[model samples]
Target: MVVFKKFNLDKQSIEVPGTRVQGATGHYRHASYVNGLVEHIAEAPHIKTLYDLFQNSVTKYGDREFLGHRPYNTVAQTYSGYTWQTYAQINQRVNAFGSGLMHLNEVILQNPQLNRWSLGIWALGRPEWYISEMSCNFFNLVSVALYDTLGPDAVEYIVGHAEIPVIVCSGNHVSTLLQNASQMPGLRAIISMDSLQDTVPVPGATSPAKILRAWGEEKGIKVFDFDEIENFGAEFPRKHLPPLEDEVASLCYTSGTTGQPKGAMLTHKNFVATVATNREGLSIYLPLAHIYGRVVDTNATFSGCKIGYFRGDVALLMEDIQELRPTFFPTVPRLLNRIYAKIVASTIEAPGLVGALSRHAVATKLANLEAGKGVHHPLWDRLLFNKIKMALGGRVEVLLTGSAPIAKEVLNFMRIAFCCVVTEGYGATEGMATATVTLSDEYIPGHVGCPRAGCEIKLVDVPEMNYLVTDKPYPRGEIHIRGATVFKGYFKDEKNTRDTVDSEGWLASGDIGFVDNRGCFTIIDRKKNIFKLAQGEYIAPEKIENILMARCNLIQQIYVDGNSLESTLVTVVVPEPETFLPFANAITGSQVGLGDNVGLAKLCRNPQVNAAFLKELDKAGQAGGLRGFEFVKRMHLTTDAFTVENGMMTPTFKVRRPQVSAHFREQVQAMYADIHASTPAAKL
Candidate 1:
């Protein structure tokens, strides 16, 4: 509960109360193996593989709920409250599903030329996704996930590259998979995650299911439902084929922000080890394909806890959370920002003493939190904060935010209002999302916590960024990780694999960081993403964007772009309508209450509006400690926010910089051209 007691400040480093980081590399590990690095998965020899983790949980918590989902009612056209299945039940299903896959795809599994069959999983965060994936683990089959945002080209590349023969996915992805089937030479069968019962019947032709079957028939591929496979597996059981620790379990494809998506071959050992290194979740909303989501679910399952699915609709997210009443919430900054805005909006709208009380409460709580006094305030909780807390499931005891840096003020505000442990995580897919995580006692924001147990971390000098391991009070350089949690390597990419991880096994994270004497890390820059301006200034776009986002209320999302060839920088600002509409009207002395799409677009194009935003941004830049060269010279505003569906953002909510540049290529060029033409030379 105290700041000074946060890290024991000793070599032993007992992490919080229950957890212990003994020796140099040990976090969330069993005390029995505290002498050195955790050799076995789950910190136990018995649980050597992921399947073992499942089996042990099933044995220990047989009656405990594992997965929960809200069944949709056809008659009422509404989703019911969460229904759960015990660990024993899911274990049975996993066994049957694995057996069923063998029964259905014997030819593909037993093919002479193929060494091992790889199955593809393409879906949202749902029970079926995990069920099908666990089945693969039961056998020694490799599992490859087709990310939801993957375009046709990326999908085809992954399917063919991984040689994925059978794909188990929801009915929604069938069309896209089939469209890319022609180019995917290894694709053989498609198993539906859900049933075809709900599929509307065709008017003149056969049922939609039949139409899909016929389409598959033409491509020499077979299609079947999830239950069909499970039933068959139950009828014809197959023995479990446990894999070695070194065996690749899943081929996780990157978001392909650049060219082709490269698969990171993550082993069962890698995942199982990471699970020990982080548990508890009530909502499964993030993409299961991402390592962050996968590790969280594994940790939850290992602890024999329940995880309920979101309604597959973002608009109804809070509604589901209120119903589920999850004790913990793991999320990104964007969601928290929206929640903060809503809370602030409501606080401002409250009349008379209520508004004053709300303001007083927030300010007092924030001050108390910063001083390490604690998050609890009986008066504030009952009179002011309980309603806001209920908005994110009243039971939430912990809030974990990651994938991007959250505003420090918002982080503190959430801690005050929700009265929970708010922690930030620092990780990547290559590390299986295992790395530094903020400690509960550490009230200070920005720095990610110490190294996770079993993983040895070091920093090598990045001369290009002028960062050295011997710098000042804190050592700064590129992050290098080597441990049980680190991934095997990129699939069939020896060059890139070699580039990423060196001969000594240190996985070069490409992210520049500074580590304090206490081992807390603050990520400063992306070595690869930073660009140099013509005026000899190095610019980290993400850092500038974060600063601007924190300072400027009008900017919902901003992508700061810098060309190495040019001296100036520019940005594509996606404005939040709540602030932007009103500001635009006031700034221009017109366009008041222009909340519609057309009106917003017009405001974006208006020269006066652009000038006003630039002025505001200039002030914000100076306020946030941005250098003159780093300030955005020109901006193109838009109402369309970057999203997963638009390929502008990854599933984790991080901006795809390359995609952003390509999407607004013309706008960027125009902005730069205007900068060049607005000079006195052009007038002359």
Candidate 2:
């Protein structure tokens, strides 16, 4: 039996419903509930695999559009349209693709020694990627995913590690694989999604198909176009090798921020269980190569919901949303942050009365929400909020954000602006994308709600960094999770697998968080990311970074660093130039205009401007109630923000700390060098 603890903020008290269970590890296990029901693992005995989920959905919603794609014009070399496939059509393609893989497997099995084969998809978000993935599960072949942005070396590593014999990829990916083909001995075939006849010729080469064919002939490998496989499969009998619930459905690779990417083996049961506990109806925008996006896609398919694909260009996502009019939008914090920044900028730039009215309407709505009253301002809703809602296609009833923590202000603003329920989820690749999620009606700021139906969560003390379960206000420690949603293990790495998951099945999340008396969890910082200074004061850079970002509008991006040799913290800030321009001008009492790169760079190093920013930083730190050592004592401002193309941010929009540190090594050293200097440090 599970017990629930309820916390009343107004009363400043906690009420536990049932007796607590003390584990042998000296940790307390307190189960929680939402809407009076204790969370327990969702049971789905009928659904055994991804194939079963798809079949069930096809039976229920065969005529509905299940997948969408944007078509490209061959002559003009531009995308001018969108198309969709019904559930029935999707089933047909999946069956044909599966049958084709089965036929290929038979051909490969003629050797009589090899018992298993793997299929790899190395493409962007497209219909064929979905078909190929499902086909692998359908034919009982292992499915391996390769990131489109991966370099030649990472590609070779993943291909060799998975022992993938066949790969389905786009033209660009074919070029990459061709470059590293000699290194990947097990890879035998390449399936191009685009037909050779329709593909445009690369600058210095013939058509990609011709190049691939010549290369394959040279390397003793076979290459096939997408249509050929479908046609061949149409002639062959369908193969029906059902996958077991415990069988590995897909091998998802980590983002490889610290080192070589490790594949997390996600079982069919893991996916099915995730879908069973998920809500339906979402427009897919995230990359399918990632587990977070893939789980959402699979869940939408399993729940008989229409999934609209974004145009390859992410800049056009808002336009796609306007066209698709999806009822649910699954997103990350970066996109939401951009949306918030754009809205604020546009509203501020609006001329005269328009700007005043927009600001007033937003302020009124936010006040109403904060006061625990209904947002029923009809006049404001019609004039302001309704237009805001229309920007998201006017049909979205729920918004889900995860992958990173979002600002409380942004989350609240979006809810009121869209007139919908916005929920945050907490999960990772190791946990199949979800271990806990916020309930529909539970609107607690900064809290990621309780554990999901199928998950159990607990906290363990980390004494080295001074995090303990008995901390004041709320218990703070490292979070550990155990559930059906947790992945099996890392593929082909027993040592890493053993290190990640313990004998009792609990996987350490590496995230330091605290559970509120109400069971709502709030993540503080990553355990591994915490560093101790020369004075033995532990610092959680992410915690300080989030606070500074939330409190300071001028800070677009920030990275905090400390070392055992240093007693004070140092920071690198990417300032919002538009916001910083006014501050700089105000500090100097002169109009320092934007777009003059040299002038802006000088302004970033200006003594007066730095002093003002340091004051702002100090205020923000004070507001966040940080210790004196946690506040940044030395800082440098850079105009360029961390970005994926620059290798400073991951594809998922997380700051690659190692990369950022390396890129800013000189600046870091300069900051430390000036620690004892007589000169005042530049601080922004």
- Highest-TM-score candidate: 1
On lDDT, the leading prediction is 1
Instruction: Give the TM-score of each candidate.
Output: 0.74, 0.73
Kindly list the per-residue Cα lDDT of model 2 for residues 340-395, writing each as its tens digit. Answer: 66676566447898888888888888888777665447888888778778877787
Pairs of residues clashing in candidate 1: 26-453, 27-453
Candidate 2 local Cα displacement, residue 13, angstroms: 15
CA-lDDT, candidates in order: 0.76, 0.73
Candidate 2 weakest ten by summed lDDT: 281-290
Expressed as tens digits, the lDDT of each residue in 1-684 for candidate 1 is: 112123442222222343212211223221222345554543356777888888888888899777888899979999999888888899899999999888877744454433358989988888888898898889988988887556567788888888888999888988777776889878888999878653555566567788888899898888888998999899999989888778999999886644578899999889877875552112222212111278777877776667788867777877888888877677777567667767776774468887889988988888888788899887887888888888876777778787666667778888988888888877778988777777765677767766666665667788766788667876678787777888899998999899998887778887888766565778876778865554334567888898899999999999989763366899999988889988888877765564478878888888899989988899999998676777898999987789999999999999988789899999999988897567322100
- The runs of at least 3 residues in candidate 1 whose Cα sits more than 4 Å from the true structure, single-residue gaps closed, are 1-6, 9-35, 39-43, 107-115, 198-205, 279-292, 348-351, 530-684
TM-score, cand. 2: 0.73
Give Cα distance to truth, residue 673, candidate 2, Å.
24
